[model samples]
Target chain A: QQQVKQSPQSLIVQKGGISIINCAYENTAFDYFPWYQQFPGKGPALLIAIRPDVSEKKEGRFTISFNKSAKQFSLHIMDSQPGDSATYFCAAGLTGANNLFFGTGTRLTVIP
Target chain B: EPEVTQTPSHQVTQMGQEVILRCVPISNHLYFYWYRQILGQKVEFLVSFYNNEISEKSEIFDDQFSVERPDGSNFTLKIRSTKLEDSAMYFCASSVRLATNEKLFFGSGTQLSVL
Candidate 1:
């Protein structure tokens, strides 16, 4: 069973535009939501994360908007750049658990 | 920043042969994890280890798979018999704490190809 589902397998955005990716999770036990950025031939790196306590969290140009009632979260990249083009994955996990359920991933391309 | 290290960035093995993927997690990290990503697929958790034992594992981890921390600094995953479907990119990750919220440092990966 897929615990987390993501949409828009691929995305393209012009530089300086906004890029958005969305994900939904089925497990309510999940309290930690994180977004990971992966480059070709590299492992996924932690980009930004948020707890269910907040409706939104922002780190520079990266923002995570979470809706607990909807069991959904989305990542928004403002002023997207070519360097930001990479595979983005949304993951969910429990507070004390050691495993994370990851989304299928969205490959973003920021064209100049 | 400290990072997890995996050896033999790429490995090719014949089917039914045994293969062991090695990893050296961050020195100060107490939690270790193994995750795999099949081509064009989502990353899946295989197992988690802490205090020298497996804390949790997913259904994909069957009897064919095993994990070990033979030395204080090294963690390894062994597949007794490689299957064609085992071809994937294996990642090793480590964290300072067990909380899922904690940041996990990941190694680039070991691309295993089973023929």
Candidate 2:
């Protein structure tokens, strides 16, 4: 299948807490997975990404845990802060494809 | 850092009129794409361009839509006949390479309202 499904349409997390968002895809052809963060009136910016060859990747407080067998991946934001509130999107793409299959976004809210 | 730039941040057009949304992708990027998101909806892929030609398109890109790289620096999406339902925030993106592993830089977007 071509769809990427993301869960928890909206999430509320307290400051200094951990915020996690999950996504699943049915397309096994997808080898590259990426997460994007979008602020109001701005284009979605690349937050972090992972390849199927690796199980996890971390940059700063952001970590992406990928499950190749389950066709699932998640974004974990450690020490969530008010400034980190935004709409997060998960997307899947094939190795050589030009287009990305995006999931319905998750609106993340961090209350300070 | 280089960024993709779009023109006419907002455009309101009457139904049946033709509208063209313009974008100038990153100077050195070779792959360009157009995507749209209706208000409160997921961002959907419209089309992708490489080597000055379209490489892929989604079902949402109907016969009324066309994409062109008219010059060395600009890529444009044209709607031959606009309808009320065509209103959305259209985004232009570009990547330095063809592989999905490369990150695509996107422009802010052009909000089109077909009235």
TM-score of each model, paired residue for residue: 0.98, 0.96
Query: Is model 1 an incorrect, acceptable, medium or high docking prediction?
Result: high
Residues B25-99 of candidate 2 have per-residue lDDT tens digits of 999889999999888777899999999899999999999999999878999999999999899999999999863
Per-model CA lDDT versus the true structure: 0.94, 0.92
TM-score of chain B of each: 0.98, 0.97
lDDT of 1 by residue, A59-108 (tens): 99999999999999999999999999999999999988989999999999
Writing each residue's lDDT as its tens digit, candidate 1 over B29-85 gives 999999999998899999999999999999999999999999899999999999999
The top-ranked prediction according to TM-score is 1
The TM-score measured for candidate 1 stands at: 0.98
| TM (chain A) per model | 0.98, 0.97
DockQ, computed on Cα atoms, for candidate 2: 0.76
lDDT of 2 by residue, A3-112 (tens): 89998899999999999999999988889999999998788889999999999999999999999889899999999999999999999999888899888899999999
What is the model-wide C-alpha lDDT for candidate 2? 0.92
Q: Model 2: residues >4 Å from true position, as ranges?
A: none
Clashes of 2: 0
